[model samples]
Target: MSQTDVAQANPATRDAEVLIVGGGLSGALLAAQLLRLPGRRRILVVESRSELGRGEAYSTVELGHTLNGNAARMSVDPDNPDDLTHWLTQHIAAGGWPESDRQHLPVSQLFAPRGLFGVYVQQRLAEAREQGRARGSSVTHVQGEAVDLEIDRDGARLSLADGRQLRGAVAVLATGMFPAARTPQTRSSGLNAAALDPWDVAAMAALDPQARVLIIGSGLTMVDAVVSLEQAGHRGPIEVFSRHGLLPHVRRQPPAWEDFLAADLSIRRPRQLLRALRQQCHAAQAQGIDWQAPLDTVRVHIGRLWSQATDVQRRQFVRHVRPWWESHHHRSPPLSAELVARLHGQGRLRIHAGSYQGLEPSEDGGLAIRLRYRGSQESVRLAGDALINSSGIEYDWRRVARPFPRQLLARGLVTPGPLALGISAAADGAVYDARGQASARLFALGPPLRGMWWESTAVTDVALQAKALAARLAALPL
Candidate 1:
């Protein structure tokens, strides 16, 4: 198609050549991908937040909240694994992130604050914007929440919360992960309504120094909640509850190991992969090496292994191996892990394996919760001064009470992803409608494709998907 045909001149009919529904990391990276490509089209990104790159994950201003991965592995550039490290090097040298001195590690191994990472993402996007401008392409940020979207033979029409509408040749849904602590649910236990936000240190600060705190879920989020409480000066007893009561293993820098998955293609089934991985870990331990060395090699093969697995195999993994996989894979940062270890040693933090039943009526102005301890049928009542819902991400769109997610499901624009993790989509990111048909106009990236790619939420996965989707959209007949 000609350059003129790529961009429509009518402001009413075509506000942009492409419309991105979310302006978080996923959306921002996708925009960068499209901008760098040779094109002459207008792109508009709609986000509710004032800032563009920081979504729920990176929007936190707390110095204690940091990315789980180090700078080397968290690059937004798929072609360059060291991109974040390079940026962080100059960032530290320029007197930014003064805390870097405490780690005593090279910039490549440093764990960066989420706020600083957001700045890096924004700067990269700005550079891409300049590149796009030189190629007669432009990107505009529309500050508003996208509530509804409709696809047509020509393109897509998007509606914002403030009653504004925009038309584009294609629309992309990059709405990031919805943390259970904050996102509304259709049917909830009312825990979120009464609980303090997991990332909200200010709310935690209001509590008495010795107030007892109850926490639900013991994943990386729970680790963050502990860090938040500590930073807020809360020295009270903390009770953490979950079905498994498993804590994330602390992250460590390990040496490179063999890419076992690449060398052995027959290890496709979950059991087979697990057995092989176990053998590798045993071998590494025998050699006085960290087990994480071998585990990191499997990161590149997850999408292929997940997508190609049978439904039965996938179920087996989720039911039997999922909790262990999560605890081992999604590791806690060292600094936060140190605090948790110290507190646990001091008897200030306790972990219980139980299932939360519901809330109870409390007369002492404290939060009361009922729980059935593991292996017991009878429920028990537990009370605390505060509660936090660190239950993790709600990937099922039907359950999410957000207007946009609800609208998309109600309108049949998208379907629940594999195993109901995120919305379903083809390997190339063309979203599948409720009818299981791949869409040409609608696309999704990041956490929305969790069901499609089991490890889709990581920065590397999103970066690769953004680049591939941008190329697919660029080739369209729009």
Candidate 2:
């Protein structure tokens, strides 16, 4: 008589055309695309949060945590490249944006607070839902966490946290990024001293303004933390350390350049691609153009090139090239970059190339952090009132303590991605078992597909994948 009993008794009666887990950008965009299909279809989106489309990255309400790019570059729809720009213009016209916030910048190039973008995504999803209704389709949003997945002959059944079960003809894992799993070094230390969330405004505000602060990563997340400290009127010295300590480059408008890599599908290897990219960077610099223009050329071809790479070559890139590639490709916004530079100039911020060794309780009831410098193994000690982990999300699902991923691995529903970077799946997002056989009713998108597509994080890439997956799932017999 319960939902679980009903789901097990009559799977088809409980089934939807597609069941999308996570309800984040990947799921929402896929739903949007599914609604555009010619035939009637049902999409059921399951989310842990009450709202849909915000995901973890855009879920922050803090003003200091802003998107890394301008409004024009963040649209969920690739066909409408300037959709966000147009939306912002309309939003500004309707007095949606604050007047004080509007005066200093161009709307097209503005790096608005991430919460505003979340609202935009929600609005877009609502519109798509209505559009689906007009086209004899339906999208239902369910609130709960899917703790386990069971594949049956009929389809797949998802067990929710509240003891409810839902069935769908097919399922897509749009689970995005998971929080970093605590390493052995981080685990032994007192969490109060070192393991603070990077996005907690209250925690950052509680820090003593004059006390030293230590941050564990030198990327965009660290930029957000610095901005939060400054906004809270903290005048303390800050230390940022990472494996390479390579900070993201500041974003800038660049002149268009020829897509030199576009025509060259022959450069399939990572080393060859790196060499070609370096040549392009040098040529662009010689022409007084930013090297990013050349780098962007490789973005579209990444999935193809990555698929062609051998496992050993993929491992080589992960070990040797990933850090520099991330720093070069994932640049920070102009405003945040300027703030970081200003802090460094004032001698209030210092960046070190090193790896965290351990954390110890200091004499002053603070954290004594140990690190090994990049080139040498000598340990260095530093003390701070608090340490925040800004090292970003952990992509390897095996390490995370989440229940659903563990269930999938145990049931042989999914495998670790190529090089153990993300959830392993086929190039088109079909879920694969440990034996490397693809599933007919299970799929994935977004960050979980990073193993197949190296450049899977950006909105542009997610949008393309969502569109493709939607079309593929839509055409399948229900």
| Top lDDT model | 1
Q: On a 0 to 100 scale, what is the lDDT of residue 228 in model 1?
A: 94
- Candidate 2 structure quality by residue, lDDT tens digits, 1-478: 1223223434446658689998888888899899877888888999988888888878888776778877777888889988888888889889886742733777878887888888888898889888889989999899999999987657789999899888887889998877552322223344333566777777777878887888888888888888878876789899999999899998776777787777776888999999999999999999888998898777778888888999999999989999998898888987779989999999999999999887865787777888898999689887788788777767777766677887898899999998777788876678888888888788999998888888788888899999999887876666
**Candidate 2 stretches greater than 4 Å from native:** 1-11, 99-105, 181-193
lDDT of 2: 0.82
- Candidates in order, TM-scores: namely 0.97, 0.93
Q: For residues 285-379, what per-residue lDDT tens digits would candidate 1 score against the true structure?
A: 99999999999999999999999999889888998899899999999988988988999999999999999998999998887999999999999
Model 1: ten consecutive residues of lowest lDDT? 1-10
RMSD of each: 2.2, 3.7
- Report lDDT (Cα) of residue 395, candidate 2: 79
Give me candidate 2's TM-score against the actual structure: 0.93
